[model samples]
Target: MGLNEAPLLFNFEVESSENFTFIPMSVRFNLDRFGLRITLAQWQMLPLEDRKLLARFPVDDDTEIEPNFDHALFEMLRTHANVEPEWFTPEEAPLWRRTDSVPEGVTHQAGLAGLTAPSVARWAELDPFKRYVLAKLSRKPEANHDFVPAMKEFGGGA
Candidate 1:
């Protein structure tokens, strides 16, 4: 779905019962296809129950849904997935925001301690979630060289 019409993103997790791991049915964007589509806003609003339901959905590295900031989608996500809705903004999410989950004093800025211009440009072109991956991959000093080239290639900077 388009961003304007997109839905909330539900991440599934499996729960174990006395006998087996049960997949809790819930309403979440199915990402068993190409493209990561979802607003960052809706993702942060997900309550515990929503996350639980998402955890139950069959997911793998291939799943490609993202959260957005549509209220309807957020409400639908909660109702359909059995969760309490909260006021969450995309900018408030830590994952979306840059952090030192990498190393302190390190950053993505150019020259001082970051990637090249082409690399940043390429990274800028990527969707936020994909950007997150690139950021994570490039966060460490060891991965900077490879990530810069990869970002440049990814964004067609070369």
Candidate 2:
């Protein structure tokens, strides 16, 4: 497969130093991205140092990370971590089609109003990509406020 056709997450490094470990994360497999879920429990078993390092890794707005493990490591993580494997191959779709960029203004007052302080605080902890998605998801056809509400939902307020 070509670069675009190949799974980008396949290049992720699960381990670099012997001591660093990862928390188990459970995710549904996506054939398009070649992703599989690992439970948080399995991640907790990793060496604390490794877990700490992975924490610095960037997760996209969709809570997705790129340059993940290759097929070999996918199997290894599943086997060793005891994570069940579910395989999928994404059907061909235009990679450039944007679904989440719904202009610059969107209202998320409904979503934000229902959230707790801690939940809102945790939302702020997310990276920009996550913030972007929140803004996109909460946008309406005729939003009054700028994407501010979604930004606050993800912990970004001005």
Candidate 3:
């Protein structure tokens, strides 16, 4: 099934028991990014009470979900994953570098920091995720100071 179908596939109910406190299953991280896919085997490994708690956790569209793992059961699943996540190299991932789409503030900041054309091209060659992070950081007022450091870390000249 597709990612859109993931929630539906795991949907079900469990009887509540006084012995087990059913907390919401909302851990704050994107499980998909970590390549953690909990399936029936992992679910079965968890105690019935833990299962009940997980079933109640809701998923939302917010990306700022903090990496909260207060739940012991959730931590166990992450640590002992049934499936491993496929890692990607910088070249393998998607590229989002469009010179026109890049905000002028970012370019100005880079220029002020003494980043030349070669440096800018190097920045463009960075993983799209890193580029995205730089773009986001560059848009903040008075945040341009971080731009050069980030560029240096990403293989651009200072």
Tell me how many clashing residue pairs each candidate has.
Answer: 13, 19, 1
Model 3 clash tally, residue pairs:
1
Cα shift from native, residue 41, model 3 (Å): 38
Score candidate 2 by lDDT: 0.37
How displaced is residue 129 in candidate 2, in Å?
2.1
Query: What's the true lDDT of residue 99 in model 2?
Result: 43
Better of 1 and 3 by TM-score: 3
Candidate 2, residues 3-56: lDDT per residue as tens digits? 133211211223322233323111112222353444556655544543443434
* Per-candidate TM-score against the hidden true structure: 0.28, 0.34, 0.34
Query: For model 3, what is the error of residue 35's alpha carbon versus the real structure, in angstroms, after optimal superposition?
Result: 21
> Against the unseen true structure, what C-alpha lDDT does each candidate score?
0.37, 0.37, 0.43
List candidate 3 stretches off by more than 4 Å. Answer: 1-102, 117-123, 141-143
Q: After superposition, how far is residue 21 of candidate 3 from its true place, in Å?
A: 30
TM-score of 1: 0.28
Residue lDDT tens for model 3, 1-158: 11221221111111222222322123212333232445445555666544444433334323244223234445656555543333332322222355335456566666777774234456556655456546654665564545665666666544
Instruction: Indicate which candidate wins on lDDT.
Output: 3
